[model samples]
Structures are given as structure tokens and as C-alpha cells.
Target: MALSDIACRNAHKSDKAKDGKAFKLFDDKGLFLLVKPTESGWGKWWRFKYRFDGKEKQLSLGTYPEVSLGQAREKRDEARKLVAAMIDPGENRKAVKEARADSFANSFEVIAREWGSKKVQTWDEKNNRSKRMLERNIFPWLGAKPIADILPKDILASLRRIEERGTIETAHRTLQICGQVFRYAVATGRVDRDITQDLKGALPPAKGEHFAAITEPKEAAELLRAIDSYQGSLPALCALKLAPLVFVRPGELRAMQWQDVNLETAEWRYLVTKTNVQHIVPLSRQALAILLELQPLTGHGRYVFPSERTPSGIRCMSENTLNAALKRLGYGKDKMTVHGFRAMARTILDEVLGVRPDFIEHQLAHAVRDPNGRAYNRTAHLPERHKMMQQWADYLDALKQGAQVIQFPRQA
Candidate 1:
């Protein structure tokens, strides 16, 4: 006879004084609910009993009430199907668990971390942009799955999550990063092909937005002179003083930390967010003096330009702060941008100063390559760049004093 729901509810109720002895009520086939007496009432565990590999084995379906009689019967019938095929259901469960654990060991997240750790070492400034992207967008969704098991759809799903967040540009970068990982996986023999290759043109294209810049030296000199005479907060003043000197991306400039600077060495080192590369900016004498002057004021906080708000002082200034200060100095977004500092330096360094284009690109944290087509490590050409930075700073000072523009012969 089949076990009824009422029988399950009252199971072990009749055996309270059995001194912790357990009993079982069998349903049709090999399914039964083992009722164990507890302090409050009873613990009903549904179990399926069977024999396989010339030995008896039992598998727990689930607990009663939660599992219910109907559900327990369904589970038992599925397990019976496995046994009928001469398979061991108990061993099958263990095999499935072991497979999952193996997949985790060979997971995309694990491989990505391995590749990033090695790649970040080659990249100076220890900028782990790949690691940051994996953690933020990819890991949460696709981290644990086996790298071999991840299909193009899985990659697309993760990329879409980033796209839906309105970070379409970041979504594209994330896809590029994924492609790198897949290539690594291919090289390592983990996968036969790069799955991200199948995702070409899957995402909508991201439009480029270029910041306005004053490329002419005479115009830049006027802007530099204005920055010098502008009245502003000490941080803003120091920022204005050093902006044209270093010409780092405004976000990198604003988020500059005290710990990454070495006044003795005249260097400002940090990870550039856009390229995810560690960048070293050789500070000019003028730039160092401005820094040393601002030290006594903002040296106490995490950021060199700490936010004015209480408790938020750990963070850097708001994005609009520098542009607002620029606006106050009469150079609106259409005329000049904080990012334009990079463009100004790029144009002048190559066209006017005759600095090596490679050095200029490296200083700007762009992807620079050697004649052999390999990226120069972080410390490449440091001494020469150090000299060039000082010269650039001196040139700016001369411009501020209304000196004539001196042009150097272009590199052939």
C-alpha cells in the first residue's frame, strides 16, 4: 500500500517513548520516509533503497513536508530509472559533485587571474585593469564555470550586462579583455579555439568622444599664463600649475595619491585607468616645487586633491571640479579641457620640441612599441625621459615669460 500524507504527518508521533529509536513508513516501490524522534517532534527523511554493483545502497531524497510524499515518489522514480540502466545512483551523485569541483579548478576566473598576474608584472605601474574588469563585470556571472564549458553565448551574456548598464564603451573593452583571456586559454591548451572570436559585431558600436584641446604653443602659452595668474584654492592653484607640466589625463591627475610620488626622484607613478597601464610621469622641477608646496596642506589625506566634504576627504575631487576651475579661468569646455593637457603635450613634444614620438607616446601611457614590435617595459628610457620632462617644463616657463616659439627639426 502507498504511504498517505497523514501517515507522514503523524509518523514518529506514536513512538515518543521509544528512547530515540527511529522507524520507517514505506511507500510503493523502494521509497520510504524514515521518521526519527526529536526533542520537538519528529525528523522525517525520505529515502530510496536499492542495490547496485552487487551491493545495497540508499539515497536520501529529501525531508518530509519540504519534500512532500508526491515529490519524494517522483525523485525515487528518477533514481529507479538510473538503477534500471545498471548505473549506481549513489556513485552518480558523487561523480557530479567531483565534476563541478574540477570545473571550478579549471574555471575562467582562475585562468583569467593567472594571465592577469603574469601580464600585470610586464606592465609597469602595476595597473591591473584586467583584474578590475573581471571582478566587476565577468567574475560574478561567469567565474566558476569551466573555461572550456563557457560558450559564446556565456560571453555575450556577460558583455550584455555591461552594455545594459549604459557603459557601452566599457562593454567593448570587457569583450576585448575576454578575447585576450580566450587566446591565453588557447595557448595553454585549455581550449581549442577562442570563443570570443565568434562574438564579432555582436554588440552595438560605441561612439568616440574627443575632448577639445588648444594644440598651438602660442595658445597653450596664453592658457598657461592665465593659469598662473588665476586666483583659486591652494589645491586648484597647484593643479593649474602642474596641469600643463605633466599633462596627465584629468582623472589620473585629480586622483593622484601622495604615496605614488617620490619628490626625491621627481616621479609621479600610478595606474592609468583608460589603458590600465602603470604610468610613470617624470616630474619637472616646476612640477615638484608645486607638489612640495601643496604637501603641507593635502599630505594628510589619501588623495593629493582631497574632496572638501567631511569624511569624503578620502576620495579625490569631483569630476567637474577641475573643469569648473577652468571655466572660472575663462577657458570653457569648447576652448580647453583638462584632458586637452595630453593633446597639448603630444602636439608640442613632437612638433615643437622634437622629443622622440615613442617617448611622447610612452609618457602619455599610450601603447608604444619598439622597432622589434614589442612593448618597452616600465623602466625603459627613464633617464632620457627625465631630461626631456625637465626641458619641457623649462620651455613652459619660458612661454609664460613671453619668449619666442623655438621649433626643433622633426625626426626623419
Candidate 2:
């Protein structure tokens, strides 16, 4: 007998059925309500059974009450029409669900997040800047779109918006990072190829530029003297003083952890986030002295330069702390920057101090490879780098005293 509205609404498990047992109420043409006993009363689902290709199959219409008797019948009729045409409605529904799942899995944002998560240990975006970049720039545009569905024009449109905001360099970097994500998607079989490959030269080329620094002895002397008198928080003061001594990247300096420093060995060993390589910086006596002074203040904290402004005291010095301190010392962004310390050290060491370029490059944590094309071990030239570091510190002291330092020709 076909199910009626009154029967459907008042449906219950068989009175003689044991606890947890289930029973079905048949309507006709393979449609039925499978009602299972529940703790409260009964649970039910609307089911449609049929045969396709000489095999029996079942499909779920929905649950009771939510899917009423009339609604279930309407769905049963539609599904019957599909079965009459020799289509297996069950298989058709499965295919539709699988396609939706595949599209969501292959979405650009999903793939990009997966790629970024794999790079968390090595990524230089210490503050989740890379994730924010996607959320702000790329995700808003192509995030939900499947990787294969995204054309080169879609990417260009996103990048052009970044460029229009006058962050031409950021737009270029965003493109590069996106290309990494697309290639990751391709490798994972989500897409057959990286669509970003076709976007070569689609955006403006990045400008060739370098950070500003006082490389000349006289100007550097003036800047060093200015830093000596520029007062700030203890963390900022120590970072500004030590910036020129070790000359590591600004991020590397600020993120310096207490555990990474070995005062006994006069070395600061840590992973280079950008290159994902271990780097050892031989600490000069001057550098060691600055650290020793700060030790009594911040040695107990997680970061050597804990941000004074934060309540947690867990985070390192802010990104702008050193640059802002430099500004207070009369060094504008065009005149000098915190990152300019690396350039200052590289230039002065190779040109004025006549240091070996390899040693300077290695100390700068740059890639210095062997003739065989393999990168030199991070500990490469440890002995020589130690001597060079001490000598460089001594030379800087001489320059601070306004001594005349001779500039030698750079090596070929």
C-alpha cells in the first residue's frame, strides 16, 4: 500500500520488534520508509530501490518529517523517470558528489594553503604574511576556482590590482609565490600544467634597486656615532648597535632566539628562514659584548630582542623597531635602513677591508657554492670567517674613531 500523510507522520517501529531493531514500510515500486528504533522513539529515512543493468540499487531521498510523504513521492517519480531512461540514479548522484568534492579539493586556495603549510618551517613570512597575501590579494579573486579553470588572464588581473596600488615589487613577489603554488598543484596531479607559465612577462618587470646604506668610511663613522647617542628601549638599542656587527638580515636579527646563541663558542647558530639552511655567525668580541650587555636584560626571554610594547614578551622585536630607531638617529630611509646593514658590511669588507669575497658572502649567509655546483656546507670557512669577523669588528672601531681607511679594488 502507498504511504499516506497520516501514516507517515505517525510512523513508529514494530511494537514486537526488539530494542535497536529496524523495520521498513513499503509504499510501492521500490519506495519505502526504513524506520529504526531510537532512544527517544524512532529514526527514519526515505529510500528508493530499483534495478539497473539487471542489478539492484538503492538511493536515499532524505529523512522523515523533513522529507514528507508527498515530497518523497515526487522525488521517487523523478528518479523513476531517470531509471526508465536506463540511467542509474544512484550512480548519477555518486558521480555528482564526487565531482563537487574534486572541485573543492582542487581549488586554488585549498591547494595554496597546503603548499604554504609545507613551507612553514622555511618561510620568511614569520608573521604569516604569506597567508595574508593570499587572503588579501589572490584568494579574493581565484581562491574558489579550480586550478584548471584559472586562466592566465585571471592571474594577470589579480596582479594588476596589486600593481595599481603602487606596490609593483610586492605584485611581482606575489606572482612568484603564486607560481610556486600553481606548480605544486600541477605536481600533485590537480592540474596537468602550471598556468602561471604562460604569464611570463605579463606583469611589469621589477625595478633593479638596492637598499640605502652608508658605505663610505666618513659617512659610516657619522652614522655609528649617531647611533651611539640615539636612546631607545634596551632591545632596540642593542639591535641597532649589533646590526652592523653581525650584519645578518633584519628578520634574522630580530628573530634571534636565546637558545641559538652560544656565548662560550662565540657563535650564533640558527636556520636561515629564507634559504632553509643552517647558518653559523661567528660573533666578534664587539658583537659578543653587545649580546653580553643585553643578556642580563633579555637572556631569560624566548627572543633576545623581545618587543617591549607587547604584553606577552614572547615575540621578537617589531619589524620596524630598528628602522624607527635609525630614523630617530637622523638616518632616513633613503639615507640608511636596518637591512642596509648587510650591504654596508658586504661592501666595506670586500672593498675597504680587502676581505675575501667568498668569506664576506658566506658571512652574509648568501649562497656560496663549490665548483661542482653543490652549495658549500654552512660550516665552510669557519676558521677563516672567525678571523675575518674579529678583524672586521676592529676595522669598524677604527672607522668610528674617524681613522682613514684605504679603499682597495674589488676582486674579479
Candidate 3:
């Protein structure tokens, strides 16, 4: 039967003899309230039903007098607005609740696993190192927490834990990796902001140190003589000889392929150079001779310096090979090393051979500023460089022959 506001308010709980039956009451309007007994011993609670999207939908507003007639009327009116807009209010409410729960439930460990699979496929060696560090250090601490809930304080605390081990460089690298992960989360709409953003200047600054190198030309000569005498593999010997002339990084030299070199043209083309640009190194006659000697052995392989352990394939030589060779010659921490060849060439070529510094810098693949405020290209000074490389090689031969050296005129 239809009910008045006073009747709805005056409704009382029925006894257990009623077997917890529910009573339905309707107002002067079509609005209805239901008072249903709980399975528990508690008294009855209330719910309301309304029409939405041309279909009847029930919305649980609240329990009885606890939700008075005025409040119930307000809720029913709001639900009518949603229904008029063709929305199922109950379903929307449930969706919103589920979304919130999911936001809180996703853990960092879940994200890390996804990151690892994606990284192995996409990232290079440097990025692979970052992934491993995160797996070993950061993941253990914060991997199980929702990425959204991880605050700046939490990241800082985690970094502090790494710093406690006196591995400041590692702490810095970990922070960088964490920042990348947070940025990834932001891109995917999983998190709003990267908390690692403000972490700049937060960690201890890395101490300045020079690269370990042999700078003196005399020391470099001694190292070279030692390498010539060393009884290592022919690939190692060829690398030692080429190291001084090319002055490329040890990594780049070790990774050189047979396709990059053209002995007939005396040109070594670095298609995949460190700067992500193609570089052409004009080979001197001496360099050509060195390669001709190595050709019979390594010419069949793809790599110029294939691993001795591998058959019919090229693997990168160990980074320590050249250094170990130098150590055997009694050169200690302060003396000449493999990488010092670059410094030795740059110094002697400029100071002793009197080649133009700009040409030297360009040949070294170092970035040089053009007069027109443009960037320098790898082949920018190729004509002068061709002659310069020949002269440089001849100058080294003269030094090896104990010729009395005279310094050349410097470039203006």
C-alpha cells in the first residue's frame, strides 16, 4: 500500500515470528523504499528501486530511518538524472570501485617482470646493465608496492639504502633506472607523475677522475715495442699495431668487421660508429701492410678480430687482453695502457708532427665546431687528412729508426 512520510518514519522492526520478512512502502509519488530483515540478528535495512534507460534498476541508497525521507528523495532524484542520461548508475559505481582497487593493487614486481622481457628485446648493453641492477637492488625493496603509491620519499629511502653500502655510483645509476621506470609508468597512464623527477642534485656528486691512459710518446713507443714482442695471437698483435694508427676506442676496434675495411682503396669505413654516423678512416701504407699480413688468417671471418675460442664466428675480444699484455711488460697503474694510444697520437700529432689541431680533432672523431657555426662531419677535412695520415705514419717510422726529430710549424 502507498505510504506517507510519517508512516515510513514510524515503521518498526517485526519480531522473529515473522521469519525476517521484508515490507515495501510507496510514497504519493512512484518512489518506493524497501525494509528487508538481515540474515544476521540485526534489524531491517532499506533499498530503493528506480527506472533507468527505459529499464528498471535498483540502487541501494541506505538503511531505513538512518536515511530519512528527505535524503532518500534526494538520492532518487540524483539517480533519475543518471537514468535520463542513459547511464546505469549501479554499473558505473561498480566500475569506478574496481578501477580504484586495481590502481592500488598493481605491484612493482609485476612491472619489473614486464620491463625485463621488453628490455632484453629492445635495450642495448648499457640499458641491460641498468635492468640487472634494478633486479638485484631496487626490485627487492619496492617491487611489491603499487607504482602509483611509491612516493619521492620511498625512492629516496631506497637510494639511501644503496648509498649505505658506499657504492655512490651504483646509487646514482639505480636512481636513473628508477626514474626511467616511473616515466614508463607515466607514458602507459599507470601513474600520474614521476616522483624521481625532483631527485636531481639529491645524490652525492661523482668524484672527478681522468681516464686511465699513457700520455707520453716515449712510454707509448715502449708499449708498442713490447706488444710487437708479446707472444699472443695474431689478432691481438694486429690490434696492437692498428691501435696507435687508428686511435679508435678499444671497443670499436674489437668490434670491427672485415666488411668495414677496404685494403685496395686504403679506406676503413665505420658504418656503425660510436657517434651514430658513418666515418671513413684513410689507411696509411703501413696500416695496409699490417692488414695484408693479417688477411691470410682473419680474411675469411666476418670480424677483423674474431675470438680465438669461437670457430667460424666473431666474438668480441676480452677488454683486458691489451692491458694484460702491457702488465706483462712491467708497466704498472701509472704507466702506458691500451687506451693511452689515443692520447699519445693526439698529443704527438699536434705537438710534434705540427698537424692542424682541427684536422687532428676531426680525425679523432671528436666533435668540432665549424667556422659557420655548423657541426663538423667525419669526412670534413679528408683531403688534408689523407696526406696527414701518411706523414704521421712516416714520422712514427722515423722515430722508430732513432732519427733526430725537428718540430714542424703549428697551424695558425
Candidate 4:
């Protein structure tokens, strides 16, 4: 006979002293409430006794009142059904527990970090930049969410927050990386699909403002004169002078090492940090003079532009060093940025000098392809680039001397 709820609530514990002994109140379908003796707090537990594969087993339904008698009966019937199908309910519960553990182990952050660790090897400084962006933007909001459970709205909300800070480009890039992570998750079977696909055209278009550059010959000449007269630190003076000649990114300039320079060949070769391509910067007579002048000060250390105040000199110049120098020289960020040097050279070299676009692109380390769809290797137009670099340096000198502007015919 099944036990009644009235009988369960009024049940009494046995006074007999026994170790781990309990009095059983049997219910239907092998369900029973075990009332422990008074020494054991008279606790009650629901148990289901069954057989599977000709073997007897007992499954604990749960404690009484917490799991009501009605609930215990439901669980007993379900386990009996499993036993009829020759399955062990205890093993099934263990499998479900393991599955849940696997899901949490493959959570979004865990998978993203695993993917990031593999990706950062190819990315140089971008590794740190990506880590910072994730920690600041993505991780706080969605890092703990299960990858399989994250909806498109969750991703869009995070990206929209980034855009709120006026870094739309960063938002776009973060979305791109998120898509990569999602695709990786899909490939690994952690998630069913990459919902980032659903977010196409979701963000506002990136509003890109070109770096402030002085394209006009006369204005560039004035800027050059101002830079030449800058009486800042020797590293700053050298970086400013070399900025126009090399036109590398500011970070690249700050991280320049001494070993990559070859004064005899008049060339400075280093991996372009942005593109991860080996780039060769032809050192003009003017550029070489500036490097040689600073060689005495920073040559002993690892960096060609080592920080003066740093004791170990392990770190190079600060990223803001040139921009700060420009500020002091009255070239506001709106008037000129350290990055504007690349634009300055790109505009002047093509508009003023008769250098071919291909030669200029090669020197700039930009990835370009011919009509044959073959990507031009970094060393593709080395000889022509060398000549073009020298002509560009001479043109800057002519401009600084207040020479008359000469316009080149546009290439067809």
C-alpha cells in the first residue's frame, strides 16, 4: 500500500539504538520513505529500488518535504520506466552531470581565450591590443555566457556599447574578431551556428577621418622647417627628422631597434608591424645622417631610439613622444599627427615627384597586385623603390629650401 501524506507528516522515529538504521514506509512502485532513528535527527529520505540487466539497484529520489512524496513517486515511476528499457537511471544522471560540466568548460570565454592564445602568435603588438579590447569591451558583458546560449542581441549590445564610446572602427573590428571566435566555436561543435552572421549591417558604417596631413608643398615645407628647429630631446629631434623620411607608423618608429639598420647599405629593414610583412626602408642621405648622428647616444642599447629616462633601456621611446614634440613645435594634432607623415609622403611623392604609383606603394609596404592577380611581394620593386626614395628625400630638401613647387603629370 502507498503511504498517505497525512501518515508521512505524522510519522515517528524508532527509539531503538542502531547504527545507520531506518524504518521504512513503503509506497507504490518500489518507492518508500526511510525514517532514520531519533539519534540521526529522524531524517527522511525517498528511495527507489529497481533492477536492470538482472541486477538490483537503488536510486535516491531526494530528501522528504524538500522533494515532496508526490515528487518522489513521479521520479520512481520514471526510473522504473528506465529500468524496463534496461537502462540504469544512476548512470544516466552521471552522464547528464558530465554533459553540463562539458558545456561550462566550453563556455564563450574559455573558448575565446583558447582561440586567442593560438591567434596571438601571428599577431605581434596586436595581441596586447586585442586583449585590452576584449577585457574592456567584450569580456565584461559576455565572457561568462555559454557560447551555445549567446544570442545575436548579446553580441550586438556589446558592439553598440563600443560604438557609444565613438570608436566605431574598433567596434567593427571587435565584431570581426567575435565572428572569428564564433566560427571557431562552430567548427569545434561547441555551438550550432555563428549568430554573428545575423548581425550583418547591424552596426553603423565606420566614419573614417584621414590623419591630418599637410599635402600642399609650401605648407609641408613650413612644417619641415618647424620640425628641424625643434629643440626637444635628442631622440625626439631624431624621430621628428626621420618621420618624414621613413613615414612608418608611430609605433613602428618608437619600437625601432638598432640591429635592423645597415648604414653601409643605406637601408633599414624590419617587419612592418601592421601587415606582418618584411619591409625595406631605403635610407636617404638625409635619413642616414639623422640615424648616424643619434647612433652614439642609443647605439649601445637595443633600440635605435632608446628612452633616455629608462635605466635599462629595454623599452623604446614612448608612443606619444613625437606627437608631444609636434605639439610643442606648434603642430597641433588637428594640424598634424605622427601618422600624418605617411599621408604627407604618399600625397607629395605622387603629386610632386614623378615617381610611379607602384614604386611608391612598394616603398610604403602596401599590399598591391598586378592585373594578373599576383600579389606584389615586399621586395618586388626594390631597385625602382630605392631610386624613388632618394628622389623623395631630395624633393623634401628642395621644399624645405623654399624651392618653387613642381607638379608631375598624373599617370594614366
Task: Estimate the lDDT of model 4.
Answer: 0.83
Query: Of models 1 and 3, which has the larger lDDT?
Result: 1
Clashes of each: 1, 0, 1, 0
- Relative to the true structure, candidate 4 reaches a TM of 0.68
RMSD of each: 5.9, 5.3, 13.4, 8.6
As for lDDT, the candidate ahead, 1 or 2, is 2
How does model 3 score by TM-score? 0.61
Question: What tens digits encode model 4's per-residue C-alpha lDDT throughout 8-106?
Answer: 776662343255466788898788888876553678889998877788788999988899988998998899888778789999988999988887788
* Overall lDDT per candidate, in order of appearance: 0.85, 0.86, 0.73, 0.83
lDDT of 1 by residue, 114-192 (tens): 7776765422222245667888999998998899999999989999999999988889989999998889888988899
Candidate 4 lowest-lDDT run of ten: 119-128
Per-residue CA lDDT of model 3 for 218-333, tens digit only, reads: 65556666767878788888887888888877767777778889888888988534466677788999988888898888889877877667766546565677667667778654
Which runs of model 1 end up more than 4 angstroms from their true locations?
6-14, 17-25, 35-43, 104-110, 117-146, 149-172, 195-211, 217-243, 249-260, 269-280, 293-338, 350-362, 365-384, 394-412
Best by lDDT: 2
What is the TM-score of candidate 1? Answer: 0.67
In model 3, which runs have C-alpha deviations exceeding 4 angstroms? 1-196, 271-274, 312-314
TM-score of each: 0.67, 0.74, 0.61, 0.68
Return whichever of 3 and 4 wins on lDDT: 4
In candidate 3, where is summed lDDT lowest over 10 consecutive residues?
A: 119-128
lDDT of 2 by residue, 230-250 (tens): 878877888998999999989
